[model samples]
Target: MCKEKIMNSESEKDIKISKRKTSYPINSELLDYLKSYDRAFKSPIVYDDLLRYVDNYPILDKDENDTFWQGVIYGPQEMSEIHQNLKKIYSRLTSDGADKSVDHLFVDSVDYCTFGNSHPFRIKIKNQFNDNHDYFYVKKADASRIYGLEIEYILSPNRINFLVFENTLVEEHISGIPGDVFIEKYLDEHTNKIRLAKEFVKFNERCFLRLLGDQRSYNFVIVLTPDFDEMQYRIRSIDFDQQCYEGKINLYKPQFFRENLDYVKFVTENLDESSIKQYQHEERALMAKRMIVGKSRLTKLLRVMKNDQIAPREKSFQLKTEIFELLKDNEVLKCETMGDIVEAVLNFILRNYQTSMTKLF
Candidate 1:
């Protein structure tokens, strides 16, 4: 038997994710599952269509910092066609295919980022009447990312809106303060540091529970909402490219990321062990409840995922061994895919919940 390489807190600091990950094509079963749930749609444009732009210029932030995004320019005929098709896609995303609603809407700018695995294109749409604007993304629909998005929607507190059309994916822009910006500017000024820390703890638990990895500061956002007397903070992940790909379990926990060192320190400084444990248990309980409520949909998704090949076999084997050791349950060792690993994790949580309830009774 091979020894499980479970990462400890000390080892987590040295963990590094691979620079590049192979994109997996969506298999027939997953596509059918997506179509059954209305997550699949037909779009006039595909991911390759956007790559035909002739030229591009770098986009800058308000502080004159390089955002690593380029504003792409297209030929007159191509631009007109792309813009019109994008508007139609936006209509379908937001208003259930009401094309007339987008008659007054125009594409303001199209930006592309070569930063990560997806290499997504950002589309800015504006309403001519009120000058109100919104953003969406177009990217190659990698099966791993699609599964991540679906899992986030089904399990997390947040609701995700995205549509898959052939090889393209359209996602509604998640609105919030970038995590790095929040850390730099808002962390000190936050009226309720405890609440923010608490939310981070919950967010950390959510990510690890679902095996969502590589939650560096920039990959997530901080959403602030006014709560009568004070502001409430919620952390939401913006990137899903790393979903269930890493072999290291600690990679799923955001606190282990160096980019999130500030958050980790805050959590340690403010939250004692018991408080942290309470928050973790609370999050797990909530997730268990969500699992029960979304059982049918989750079942279908997992069925597709278990049969899909989203990660390397070595990674799947390593992760399953580590998880099996950590939980002291042989069930995880039986998992052959990342999806099976996720199913095992969820089952572990549900089993623990049932045991606790039985003890209470």
Candidate 2:
């Protein structure tokens, strides 16, 4: 859990992140699972190697705002070698370790971020010939984050591409406008707001069902698609460090966050309770279908999780009890681990996807 505090008595609601969290190492079982699923790769460069930067400078966005990233500088002797290895690792993540596609790519910039639990190093690679650029991240491996990424890939509509090395993790960047920026700049400009509203409800439901927490406005993104008639919107989570770790029930629900009050307002003003319930039902049914398709993989992953220590025992027990009160199901009460709770919740969704959504509200 993020040693954070939420003040619901004051204004609307406020959530603040505290200092460092307890680090959980990747156990043997999770490593085996990654290797079996081909998500394990041997990278020539590890996370500690990137920490050798001799100096760093603060970075700024085009709008002259702080981007919360530091432009890392490395010694000339080590810079060339590190960038080359990073490019190759990017190749493995994108093309299953083929380097032929990356001969023209050059590392443009390397930046380090201290904003989240991962404290990841972001690499920007650009095509020398066409100037087309892309990004990937290198971060210390944590079992909780790895589980979040895997579950999101399997259950969510978005596709996640990532790899796990010994103590390192490599992940492709999720492309979209940040949720906070979208809400601030574009929310008033669009005449057709119903599509975004519906997507928000589904997005809210998706996070709660999967127990993904701390999704304030900035933790997610908004992807806009051009439909035949109107614009279609999809909400995606960019950060996955808080997966099933928080003790509070409202923390898993995005609608309860203070930063997301604007979105909550939009949802409440435009969507009726019945419409919201219908969208929740639709999202659950879709998840049930996905679960059926990814049964084998999900089963193996959950088995590893059931025996793993992703969160403190006290927190898990608290969340489990809270969920049991809502579900009135003995299965949730019988859960001894967060993994078991997740598995039971999944079974509940499979069994009551169409009928039990009424309890969600």
Candidate 3:
């Protein structure tokens, strides 16, 4: 009798567990659509989702008393708003809808996973703005779990596999560097194009200085042309939403851009030792400083602000003061390049912290 009772209890528990489970599987069609966007299969969020999917992620059981969803619901009203926004974006791309088709399609996938409510189906569309233009990635506002703010990412038609870079914070800003810049060929035929090397570095440096922090891979891209010359390199920023705000943008600063002409010249010469020692030293020190300051700033800002990345007025003022003190004295203040400025600010923070600790002890 005791053994039968134990067996019965185990069976009941398994049945209850199975009944409570939810599956947010990515169907073949959805995977096909994602591939059509030409994006890397492995996204940071997607990886996290996959782990949950495989490991039987926990979700709250629906309460019988509270029949209403707690979070922001797209339920008809929000969907209309999203539709209007898409129409507006579509109209901007085309004055008249004659050139191509604008098709709205729905795929059975979780649009969002939030604390209150989750959207089980995702709405996507194919926009043919023009002949040469690429299809745009579209998404609607879905209630967020980690951050209440709507989380969305525009899918790109042209994608590059950057797995080798390990997806750092800085790499997300750039798309690809120009790949065709052979030194021998450029010198023999087109020497003027050599100036592009400096311009490329300068553009990235300016962007880096403007952001102040957050440098990682997948944020930036380096495209090298066939010749292997630095001058012919084309650099493009992939992520811009995080330009001025806190984590609101999810981007990195452009401090990693190499600026020194001698360094560029050495790279052009195929990694010669002319400025190798100085280059390596500067790179290491700058990298160390960037990590320290970036992490410190992120932690301090996060403490003061919620998911919105906005802090109270008084808190903002205090943060600014702290940051100011950290960066009051550093050689990077004199730097003309974004790369140099980042290094300078990093050094400032490190020096400040060390000095303060010394006095305290």
Model 1 pairs in collision: none
Which prediction has the highest lDDT against the true structure?
1
**TM per model?**
0.95, 0.93, 0.29
Candidate 1 TM-score over all chains jointly: 0.95
Whole-structure CA lDDT of model 2: 0.86
| Model 3: CA > 4 A from native | 1-89, 94-133, 139-200, 223-231, 246-252, 256-361
Candidate number that wins on TM-score, 2 or 3: 2
Question: lDDT per residue, candidate 3, 127-236, as tens digits?
Answer: 34433322222222111111111011211112222110011111111225322223322334444443444333343333433332232223334454556554354444
Q: Candidate 2 at 210: error in angstroms?
A: 0.8
Q: Give Cα-based local distance difference scores for all models.
A: 0.89, 0.86, 0.31
- Best model per TM-score: 1
lDDT value, residue 215 of candidate 3: 26
Please provide, for model 1 over 8-57, each residue's C-alpha lDDT reduced to its tens digit, 9 standing for 90 to 100. 33235456998998899988898899999999998998999999999999
Worst 10 residues of 3 by lDDT: 143-152
Q: Rank the candidates by lDDT, best first.
A: 1, 2, 3
